[model samples]
Target: MAGDLGLWGIPVAIVGGAIRVSTPFLFVSLGEVLTERSGRINLGLEGTLVFGAMAGYGTAVLTGSAWAGVLVAALAGVVFGLVHGIICSLPKVNDIAVGIAMMLLGSGLAFYFGKPFIQPTAPDLPAIALGGWSDLPQVQAALNVNVLFLIGLALALVMAWMFRSTKVGLTLRVVGDSTDAARAMGLRPAVIRTLATAAGGAFAGVGGAYLSLYYPGSWNEAISSGQGLMAVALVIFARWNPVACFWAALLFGGAGALGPALQSVGVTKGYYLFYAAPYVLTLGVLIATSSTTRALSGAPGELSITK
Candidate 1:
């Protein structure tokens, strides 16, 4: 029975897929956590993600340096975040509305500019050969992890601690809780939120960099596939905790990888249906946590959605 279904390969493929697929989710969710923690939401991260992919790929193509591409992508995210932050800070401007607009704008710009680089080849990021000790090829393939994934894991731990122990984290929490309270503390809410939003964009950009320079490793318009928008829901599902976001991302990634894993083992029936698992999981998570009577547990007080 163990060998009948290509037993070991199934789990191995799923595990490998989870690690590969979750990097974008991890980065975007972390960025969203930061943005939402500052009492602002940048739904436009979808645009940022797409744009980052293009910029990162184009930079890598031009400079022959994947690292430079990641850096440029991050800068692009900062610019997008700054734009979203500034516009949303205006009186009576709806954050959601501006975010939608930004999404369109970002994607449009990326498509137009990225057209040139679509045919060009870019350097791919190198992976850590963690599976070299494994004698089995399946085990070796599954164990090969990327550096960005490790960095993401380290970031989650640092974020969890920062939220609990740092002055900057506390200040972010304070602003996220109440604008009036933040002002009373002599902190400028607008400035803080703008900066925070930009920082969040930077994270999203790196996530974009990972998508193009690693994983599927290419520049294309359709690369993001709503991961940025979904990260918003992911933030809520994570209860606004960074460490929770990490685990949640892997769960999402695993769900995403289910179809491919099954197909790799000759389970092709209903393959397309399996691809929907992540969306179904996202919907289920939203349904389970959503409440009309009160704010969600761990939600920031000043978030408009909770209000």
Candidate 2:
């Protein structure tokens, strides 16, 4: 017998892991969606993610309220986004370079502040029982989705509506499409980008908060594992659509859980390969979507990366 490879177990494990793993990606992807839609890219989201995790966990431990921790993390993310936006807006300072620098700064800041939270045990986010209908234990566990997961999905839908229907979303898209056009239309490109970056950072911060307060409590050097960076790649894979980011996040989450699921099944031979699935999938998506032959296509036209 190859263990209990029943009809219910594997799917339950995957669904559970996808719900858990998708939290961070959902936040990061959503944040990137906002920033990119405003005609800028924040590579420093990696730093924002780590620092947010540390800040959120530390705050929750101190205040005994996970919500308070989320607030503090969002604030920290705003500050990081402001710094990143301001630096990128300056003449001669490339967005890519600024993003890399912010990543280092964010990671370093997390390491500095995360020392005390390295211990086991901190306040965690509460989960909502959406699977009460299922009598099976596996079904219940799989359906014990976190409140943040629901929030993330809601945010995606709201953002999609905004991007397609709202004035602010229209302005963001216009700014991303052409800076000169924005300037002509009396829109402040710098202000729009700065604000968008801040909003994006806040989202990323929430993602970090989920990591520390929900999925995996406590903090350490390996707390993040490049989830933030992979999120940037995911935004591209999702074609900068928040709704698509949600689905992409779920896919990435499933890929992320493959190794652990295999281990649970008593298979560990290709563990490392499973770990690489998300990145491999991301690269494949990028190659499929991007084309050097067509100049300024697929990506936002005014985006620095494409130019």
Candidate 3:
């Protein structure tokens, strides 16, 4: 194992792990970016994620098709997003509080429905082969990448382009920056926010589906470990940029894989600490970048959380 590290195998392992594990984070962070760009926060994304996992796994198990699972999970995510949008739009209702409630509701629903999916086996998603050039077994293992990673990267680029160059993106930014200004321009802030939330939910749902149908092929209570929540922090760390979200998610994925990679290489001491690397990194970044003054400076003016 030490020899493997000496041979630069660790870097391959890290890259492979990042590609595999970052899919969920990428989805969640991108979703959060969309929501925040629309001047709202959906803390309940954790719930959307878990429920999407359950829905995806259950659908795949029943329908025998991974695509069916993805579609169903996306639909469920939209429902969760719509619910969040409606609740947050109510007069005097705190969006944060509603987010928390939605989280509880989503998690509870997932737990209730996920009981059947806790079994040892389920249909897994097919992987696209991209390591054909590697002759060494370890190299192949380390080079193998999931197709979803490619899709995620493409989505990031698409989103970045949309945000930077599209009329719809301009309207979204305007609404997020100032609801009053948007209203003055005949744009409905509520409608924009609702649509963004729903779209974000769909992305988050796909993230959950990837978890259940690809990286880990079984459903259980412990299937997700705050990936959804950390994704929210990641979006902030990325400054609400979808492209940055992609890199941030990959970084977080590498952090997450450190412990397992070490264990695979015959080092297991401080395993628990390694498992916490992603969260610790998240906290550190938050502390470094977040401040009342900076929030006021960089955040959309109409965003209540920044205020």
Candidate 4:
């Protein structure tokens, strides 16, 4: 597959595709990490992701600013997050079940509201060309990075630092690790979990924005392609570390590019198999990392999957 890129062209296309596809993964995985760390799991982010894509595309089409659309998308996600947070906080409620319900609700609402936007052309986020010195057009295109990708990188770094250094991060960690402990310390576990879920939703919403306003930039029903759901696996694989999430996203992104990269290199047979690369990778990671005796070392205590 590397040979198909024609010397410098090979790595360029794959790298470009990886960066393009990884943007959504980066944002969604980070968001999921935040929510899980707060002792909650939200499966409904898939719905939020789809809805955000619709909302962002529709807003950008109407308002003529992709950034405005992104803002709207984030707000929509916040609403979804708040709903999940509030519902899950009630006694005897199952967080996983609530997440499933929210997922359906978000997707349904987006489909209903997004019908008219299917064919519209919305403003896209701007790109920064970092490969200007390269004489190869392919290299330039591959290096033409999205602003959101850079932002995701910065966010990963910031999140890593915040989790280690900030009071708020410590509090969130405390709430996630032990609800009773949080209560003993006079902290409201429900409130903290609720807020964390909301923030997670916001991040996922931005991920959705990147989908509609960046790579595969368009409005449609089939836009998500499971990136939202895949993010859950990503968070787990990253061991709840933000920096690790970024690297994991890139790895997944590269896998996702395999089919295209292979085709670009003149390997036309079995192209569809390459499309399964990311999901296959996810499954492999799950199996390789799975355990029956105890939860992963860094898992938040209240997270349902670990239990």
lDDT of each: 0.89, 0.88, 0.85, 0.91
lDDT of 2 by residue, 125-233 (tens): 9999877897676677777889999999999999999999999999999999999999999999999999999999999999999999988776787889888888988
**Which runs in model 3 stand beyond 4 Å of their true positions?**
1-7, 296-298
Give stretches of model 1 more than 4 Å off: 1-5
lDDT of 4 by residue, 1-307 (tens): 3454575554676798899999999999999999999999999999999999999999999999999999999999999999999999999999989999998998899899999999889988999999899776777778899999999999999999999999989998999999999999999999999999999999999999999898799988888888888899899899999999999999999999878887776766897798999999888887877999867879999888878
Consecutive 10-residue window with the lowest summed lDDT within model 1: 1-10
Span of 10 residues, lowest total lDDT, candidate 4: 1-10
| Tens digit of per-residue lDDT, candidate 3, span 1-307 | 4236553665667777888889999998998888888899899999999999999999999988988998899999999999999878878988788888888898999999899888846577777767778666666766666667788899999999999999988988999999999999999999899889999999999899999998876788888899998998888788888999999999999998877676666665775578889889889877877675555345566666787
Write down the TM-score of every candidate: 0.97, 0.95, 0.95, 0.97
Sort by lDDT, top down from the best? 4, 1, 2, 3
Off by over 4 Å in 4: 1-8
For candidate 2, what is the TM-score?
0.95
Q: TM-score: which is higher, 1 or 2? A: 1
